[model samples]
Target chain A: MNPISSYLSSSIGRKWIVALTGLGLFGFVVGHMIGNLQVFIGPEPLNRYGHFLQGLGELLWVVRLGLLAMLVAHVVFTIKLRLENRAARGTPYAVTTRRAATLPARMMALSGLMVLCFIVFHLLHFTAQKIDPSFLALHDDKGRHDVYRMMILGFQSKAASGFYVVAVGLLAMHLNHGIGSLFQTLGLNSAKVRPLWEKGGVAFSWLIFLGYASIPVAVLTGVLK
Target chain B: MNLHLKVWRQKDAKSAGKLADIEARNIPEDASFLEMLDIVNDDLTGKGEEPIAFDHDCREGICGTCSLSINGVPHGPSETTTCQLYMRKFKDGETIHVEPFRAKTFPVVRDLIVDRSAFDRIQQAGGFITARTGSAQDANCLPVPKVAADAAMEAAACIGCGACVAACPNASAMLFVGAKVSHLALLPQGQAERTSRALKMVRTMDEEGFGNCSNYLECEAVCPADIPASVIARLNREYTVAAVKDGVA
Candidate 1:
């Protein structure tokens, strides 16, 4: 606990954790995005892919457990760093009314929390096969539960699709800062490279949001059934 | 060029401060910002009024002595120190609002003179390399990559100016503490005492009543040395590592 405490308190230690956990989560997002793109491949292929993933059974659980650990570690480290920063500042500095904090810096924490909440709800709605009975009843011609069909059915409700859209939008905002910050924390940012990194982060975030959100929107609009 | 100045005037720490407007009629537009102040002081002297007393030395922007919140910016609109700011940057007949560095730890002594001794105390707590001086060892004795050495030198360039504190909305000395920690922690010469040094310096920085860094980045922007905010990140990493090592022991 003391070692963990010191790690929590140290500057570089926090960054190392952030970088490692961030990279892990980034990899997960890439894989998740690719798997999700199956939705656009049409229902048959996507449902088959989902069943195949479900067939992995114990191996899939191992992968999921590993991802859960990584996510938990990332969240814990982030909250610890934030709290430490607050404690270090004994009093607030004064500023004139004309000079306000920039929008991105001010909203980073809020956006991050929103993304966290969204992830939980997302897992409940789509992954855990709970909360929605219609998703549980979804089956393919082969008599296997079709996760892809359930995803489409879930998004058919305007309220659910709207919520997913908003969540994905906020996730983009979180990634906008988080991605650039990950490079900076790892000591990879420089004057020459920062602008490129910033642009890359923006591009990556938009791509993820657009790709992830499109499925739900398409299903809700009847572009997919 | 003539300019109107509104400067904060306070008799003592306990007294409520006020903005005292004074006319600074000058003939030279090319004068440096402080030089313009000198002219104003001379005018006040001629009128049998007390001259505005502000902290300044070296005028070369090397020393971190000159501190003032010009208009709303820490060193005026320039990305440099107040001493490096020239009157040529300002327009004639413009009204400049000058005030002392406003932070709880930095109380005004008189006029623009703030007691920045808190920074000094934090530095004294651990900001030095404890390595004993010896015969000049071959620079090759320690193989430091070029990148690490460059980062260390950049951190070492901090002049202990309280500008970072003044510019920060939280008055956090994360930049200063980060700079001090990184300067030593990154170098082979400073590695032996890295853990202890970080612990002592950070404790002192916190004890001095400086605010935490919320990543506002104003400290980096206002810093005359242009020290990067990455140093703070490095400091955070070092501190965490040290704490972990200490815990294991």
Candidate 2:
């Protein structure tokens, strides 16, 4: 086999790809949460922010496509690894106990799958405006797409926002393990750095959870009119 | 102290098996786990019943030959080999589960013995240096730094135990491969084959049906040799460098 392809397909190399793409995805989600938190600053700033992204035009599409590619690689390789993991364990132990593996570490692929489902729903609800068609028609007094009020109106239904929070929760759980694992996979985790990254992973996961969920919570609680 | 035992009873590789409940009566607290098993086997032999077959050698924990999953934890709830485990860890009447290591690479050879030749095959891939087999070479000939020497010694402490494999959720052999590769890659004597050693061993590890490391650290927790998870990181680094060189060349 060609060395490059062989390396890319090797079990260790595959993890590097997963980690790199996960890093990319992690960046996007953190940025997404920060941008969405503009809801706290009130409507005009939030809508203007949305319009700014839209104003990026073709460059926005480039970013979107790039993220899509990363997501595809992340999901495809993760599922492939998960299946292979199952096959490698010929038989389940009659009894097993967790010694050092954290809850997030064990729930990695499963949580990722759940987060994927939420991503699809989120895109439909906000990005494509499929879940709530009225979101497409909503406009501010300035006639820009009213992303701020759209969010407020979109989050009017408790169920949608609840699922959003739940999805973010699952995403945070996924991040809890993934953030630390990427360091190890990329050979960046030194013995001293390992514990730091593990704790950092937890801190970052909670930040993600609070950052994203705050918007939905504020909307549902009528803090955002 | 008497105890209940759930021993995996398999006649052979081709046969199915289940945990057979056997009463380990009159066991002494000071008896090593294997001794307790010997006592149980003696009882079975005296009664003309088939005794539970387990793998053990050196009774002292130096040999990685004793493979048992006592109560789901590899080598029991201790950071030592099965031979080092004693009855004192258990309470009277507590049921202990003894079974072979489970992995696609390590197949069950008998009752409590899995075919660990998979580890041997991985070792044979690139686990050694090509140093001249003779009396100790002049220590002054090749100078090894203390940091490298210590790391190599730590990695070399691996007894080729499959506890890492047994404990890994994905049944990964990365820890074992990592230790072997790290040990050789750290020394000047091992420099000649370092690049190829990493490439071949990891390739063989994957081809042998070992799963990818998810960095769960379970292997490090259960490792009798105390092989740090950092060796796995080293393996990843070494392979990346070697693979890149191979690709570029």
Top-scoring candidate (TM-score)? 2
Quote the positional error of residue B87 for candidate 2 in Å. 0.5
> How close is every model to the real structure, measured as TM-score?
0.79, 0.97
Model 2 chain A, TM-score vs. native: 0.97
- List, residue by residue over B1-249, the lDDT tens digit for candidate 1: 888999988787778778899999964877777888899999999999999988899889898888888987877777778888888888889988888887777888888888989888877888887765877778888999998889889999898878788777667788898899899888888888888888778777766766655566778888889898878767766776666566666
Clashing pairs in 2: none
- For A1-225, candidate 2 gives per-residue lDDT tens digits of 888789888999998899999999999998998898888988888989998999999999999999999999998888888789889998889999879999888888789889999889988989999987878889889999999888888888899989989999999999999998888888887777988998999999999999988888988888987
Per-residue alpha-carbon lDDT of candidate 2 for residues B1-249, written as tens digits (9 for 90 to 100): 999999899999999999899999999999999999999999999999988888888988787888899899999986799899888989999988888898988889889988999889888998988767779978899999999999999999999989999999899999999999999999998899989999999999998999889999999999998999999989988999999987787
Error of 1 at B51 (Å): 4.6
Give the runs in model 1 whose Cα sits over 4 Å from its true position.
Answer: A10-28, A48-102, A117-133, A157-159, A186-199, A220-223, B4-6, B15-23, B41-53, B102-111, B131-152, B185-188, B209-216, B233-249
Error of 2 at B141 (Å): 3.3
Q: Give the Cα error of residue A158 in candidate 2, in Å.
A: 1.0
**After superposition, which runs of candidate 2 have C-alpha atoms over 4 Å from their true positions?**
B135-137
Q: How much is the lDDT of residue B107 in candidate 1?
A: 82
- lDDT agreement with native, every candidate: 0.78, 0.91
